[model samples]
Target: MSDSKHRHKSVLKKTDEELLTDDLTHQLALHTRQGHNKFLSESIIPLMLCFACPFFVRSIVFICDHCHGSIHEFLQRLLFDHTLTLKDVLENFFFFKWHWPSAIIIIGFLIYAIIMTMLLPGDEYQGPITDTGHIPIYRNNGFCYYIVSLIIFTILTVVLKLNNLSPTYIYDQWDAFLSTVSTFAFLLCFCVMIKGKYMPSTNDHRSSSNWLTDFYRGVELYPRIFNIDVKLITNCRYGMLSWALLSVIFCMKTFELYGYTDSALITCILTLVYLTKFFWWESGYMKTIDIIVDRAGFYLCWGCLVWVSGIYTLPCYFLVTHPKQLGFQLTILILTLGLLSIYINYDCDRQKIQVRSTHGKCLIWGKPAKIIRAKYRLLNGKESESILLASGYWVLSRHFHYIPELALAFLWTCPCGFQYILPYFYVIILFILLMHRAHRDDQRCRLKYGDAWIKYCDLTPWKVWPKIY
Candidate 1:
């Protein structure tokens, strides 16, 4: 064989660690990595919300006396009115109070969740390779942890009433609990940033040179502490698990205060079903943008810790006090639509998983699946192939799954009725988030797959909504 051909063969056979240390291959990897921008979004906005969200929930949703007015009028009085002052804002919106009991419970529960994750038996799944040649090994025990935790919590709160702990504890302490979770988010972000800088788990990390950027965007792709995956604990266990628990907690609160309101019950049940769907398909999520591309920084870590805990449950929280009848017909209509959206969303994910797992050999919608075998080169100069799904819901839009996701959010929020827009905040935020994610995913794929991605886009036309987006 020729000397050049022999050298290429040797390079291809090198281990991932050796390939990463090779200077030429490392340089090739850098060329494929995408750049991060939008400094205002990455830094300032999230910081402001980190402090502001709790205040909004407490003052506006929990204690606001201006519900009699229209949302426009409420905003006008709060923001545009000349009568507004710093004193009023401080007194109403920025009051800080600490409740040690609630704070301790919140902290203890997080630690307990970590313990559960460590002890739980889970299937092992390997994530995609990173630019630095590290592939994350995740323990897919989320569904197990979720079910076990719920059972334990139900026994403690409802069945046994251990230590006088009731399901309504979170509801009764909502004000202080919100503050505690938010504070934890801030602290968690700071600790994660420090750890990423000094004690990253692997070579798949870098400093942005700017501390603020490093803090906002995260320093590491995959971070671990004491052999525990930080994102798995924060994102899956702490964030998503809290979202599910709070839904039931809010439902319990509604039952305690008012009778069993159909609206609140429907919202809570549907939200649980959707979250159950999440845990079921979580392995797919580990490969998506949130886990794959985003680093262990404030945007992700703090979001899972705080935003998922607080904002994701806003509709249920709003319904705790503001129960609605919705009657029989309306309830049936909303329930049917909500359940259908959940199934479609689940099916969309299933289709892609099916095609990828079977190498496009499976039938989609009773026909042979269509796929694009997008070819690319890894940092080692070795060619690789990725399947770009084009069958089932994927044929409708590049991110057709997101459409059903947004619909599910709206359906759950619908129980709150149109009397106030506060409960619909989740729907609005989800739309914006999913839209941005769809765009970001496209850009990431384009950078990774180049011409093959372009061909896939040519075949799929729609970005998210068919013939509209």
Candidate 2:
């Protein structure tokens, strides 16, 4: 106990950055101790809390009512209201009547996700279904459910607000709750439905003439035009679309909460516009818009969009709708930060691409030279060589691009405010996810590049960012 207390005191005395680093180390240590099952255990508690909190509060209210004039008054009447228990105090404000349907849905989804995570193979596979000869299964299911749920939830929320129903009524805005549950459901399903085992590895060295032609041309022209290559474009579009849609929903709900002019229409239009841009630009214009993105692009884009927009924009929309609930200055600050981050990230990517295209070879400090060659095997057993330009941005940091990427994520999520535990959840999750991805990429490189990778790592030690990370 004494040792533990001393350690706690030492941690408390550290600078904020040091403390945060320590916390991260502690979290990673815990994961190491617990193994991969740590994810399951970490998630189980939150899932339970989401369902259990409402029930726990309801039970307390029920018991309080039996002996009291009013639960609040009774609590106040006893031991001085100031001395009320933390549970009683929380029950007073964030109380909600338990809804069996929502609870069951949440629990069911949680269970399904756990099963899928445990049972599914880790190997990548082609999706079972295709749209226009493209691998569209993940996005199709995720987006379809997201759109359907948003429509249903919006309609229900409008009806409830018009009827002057209490916000605490579970059915009032049940769609938001349900959509949350369903998103997890699909994510779980995606994990379980791995088809990648049958699919060829990206690293396989083969000729492009036969198999590449078939794989690329098997899809219809329209889909093929959208750059739906299995090796490059993964299932990130679905995640991005889902997050953008969810943001609109949150914005609409915020407008409703504030009794302001209905902005749902505007929000919907913006969402559609972004989705269209994403499909058009991300799908086909990768080389035009920016370069260097590969399979990782899909995950990076979607992860940032969904996690940040979902957590930050949604709650802020509610607060905006109910301005009394949140301060105006803080809201503006968050929005500004998001805009800044986005601009920086986009500009950085553009500069990198433009420099590479214009120079033909990457230039570092006016010196032009090649560091390494990338060997790609086509589907038909032919080998091709592409130079890996390690000079320009690549020389600065191993993964310089990730710096702006993470910054953008932080900016998008910062607007969610510091008032609730839920808002900060995305930040925590993203940090861990990105770190794990970096580690995986490192392992892949170690296997593929052998000695060359060691040299590259030595030259550019930083993985995601410079110095700090």
TM for candidate 2 is: 0.47
Model-by-model lDDT, in order? Answer: 0.79, 0.41
Task: Supply the global lDDT for candidate 1.
Answer: 0.79
Per-prediction TM-score to the true structure, in the order listed: 0.87, 0.47
Q: Per-residue lDDT for 49-107 in model 1, tens only?
A: 65666566555543323444146666676678846566776765566556798788788
Q: What tens-digit string does per-residue lDDT give for candidate 2 at 398-456?
A: 66656655665555444433444343444566577667767766654443344556667
| Candidate 2, poorest ten consecutive residues by summed lDDT | 216-225
Best by TM-score: 1
Error of 1 at 97 (Å): 4.5
